[model samples]
Target: MEQLLLNVVTLVTFDGAVNWTVGFLTTVAIFAILALALNIQWSVGILNFGVAAFFMVGAYVSAVLTLPAPEGLESYVAGWGLPIPVGWLFAMVAGAVLAILLGIPTLRLRDDFLAIATIGVAAILRSIANSVEGLVNRSRGLNGVDGFLEDQVQGGDYRWVELAIALVVLLAVYWLVSRATASPWGRTLRAIRDNEDTAKASGKNTVKFRMGAFMLGAMLMGLAGAIYAHRSGTISPLTFSDLLGTFFVWTMLIVGGSGNHRGALLGAVVVGFFWFGTPLIQESLPDWLGSRVFQVRQLLIGLLIVVFLLWRPQGLLAERDRVSRFVTRGPDDRTRGGDQGSVWERLRSAVSR
Candidate 1:
């Protein structure tokens, strides 16, 4: 047993830990942006399940745009030779456009139907990415794109600089989201989320508001995607695989407590640590145990999701009241729970009363 323990410890040390503090902080910045995107949709627009598609779109756009012209492709499009910032901006614009297009078809549908449509859209997007050689360089993926910050700093202690930049971006996003949610535009979005018909009757353009929320949310997600692409120094269709990457974003948003940016950021950091830390911890176990640890870890993650859904569906730091409290009418108003209650139950309650 002692020998086995020693071997495990040695493996971890030998594996050579990357500067995890920097890696983790970078992940936090990325997922915090993603969670805020979802918050705009789910918390403010009552939309769900389309975030993955937006993220994938953003990633692909940034990667493809930043990629140097491949031999044959040079004939058709000129390489911009732009910096990562410009690439990021392009990605955001693509995200917004895609969001508008997606919203046009799915936003008109009711909840479950909308979810199905959005999931289908995500699948379609992934399929196109996998098949389109001209667009995403097919299955081979984008290579040689410069890391966003690689040129900005150099040498050993650069991780500190990376952390500082991430913090600054995080703070800026917090301010933006907070201000938007506090604005009248945000109030309209909340009303639409809580009660679309009421919001429409109250002189708000519900459809337009939902679309705007989705587009803005998508823009944030795109910014994150751009950062991630540069952070990794390359990207592939596989990078945005719904199972591997998209689900993690969902986990971060849920764990952080949707609706509030701070909760999203905290949730992202906590979940990012767990996602990376678990594997590190497992690597230190006996070889016999480490071989099976991945499966066990996945099982635990699944269990955690189930438990959180049942006991804390709103998440760890969910608001006691939503951010749009000023526009809210009453305490017992059905809008309090929004569209979460079963339609039949709502109807039955109305009839009973």
Candidate 2:
């Protein structure tokens, strides 16, 4: 019992440092994908409470696609034994398809109702994963899913391979999402988010835009799951859980500041740190409290959520749309769109405006 409470050793040595660094970066990458997915929905004023479903679909789909069929020990598992890359592609498609199917009817619902409907969809998927043996091998989960890496890297461990892939993927996705949010398309989504009726009135196909954004975000979630499965070498329905996957990702996005890509990425990093750090923190706690230290951490996390909701709702970084200032444009220019006080000067101008 006392030994269980030992502090987590830091990655002091070079080898250990490399491993930890890779693992940390991989964590950041995966959560960045998930948080960005959530941000896509939230920034568009779409309340997606079932983020776990898309994540679960992606992981399971990739695992099923890539894994070899189980022998006597396992039963009713769907294993195509395809290449991992194929699995990743299909996983993303699967997530997008799932989102489309779910979003078709559910998107019509507004706000809380849509949120509830989405969560219900997540619950439905979980139930199916548990009940349908052919779907995901039921509770046993699909295993032996690393044939691609074994063939490609053929090395000491696949962690480095995964880290490299994750970093590259993170950078690529970050650039794409950033470009997307800065484009006219992103502006349209924001317009719909702020006022769907106005956007529709202005001839924007609000429904199509919402559906497209939903699909795109789900694809990212799916991609995250695929990479995660490749990294972890296995996946189960339990992997995309409400508490850990869905709610946790949501918390990160909210805490990081939604509607901003940087905020979403930063949120992912911070939340990921706290998440992985919790076990170490618990182990480091005094002997008497170490066992229950996890509960304390949970308490702290909940308290943070509550405090942020009540007070700092905008989070550590406020959404940057408030200040789309051109360096050349003077304050007197007053761009026709709206709010041209360079954010900092907003307070000064507020009294007069």
Task: Return the top candidate by TM-score.
Answer: 2
Q: Per-residue alpha-carbon lDDT of model 2 for 30-131, expressed as tens digits?
A: 878889888987878888888888888888888887777767767655676888889999989999999888888878776687788878888888888888
**Alpha-carbon shift of residue 336 in model 2 (angstroms):** 18
Off by over 4 Å in 1: 1-18, 72-78, 155-161, 286-289, 322-353
lDDT of 1 at 215: 83
**Model 1, 3-50: lDDT tens per residue?**
101222334453334455455666677777787777877766455566
TM-score of 1: 0.81
The CA lDDT at 85 in model 2 is 88
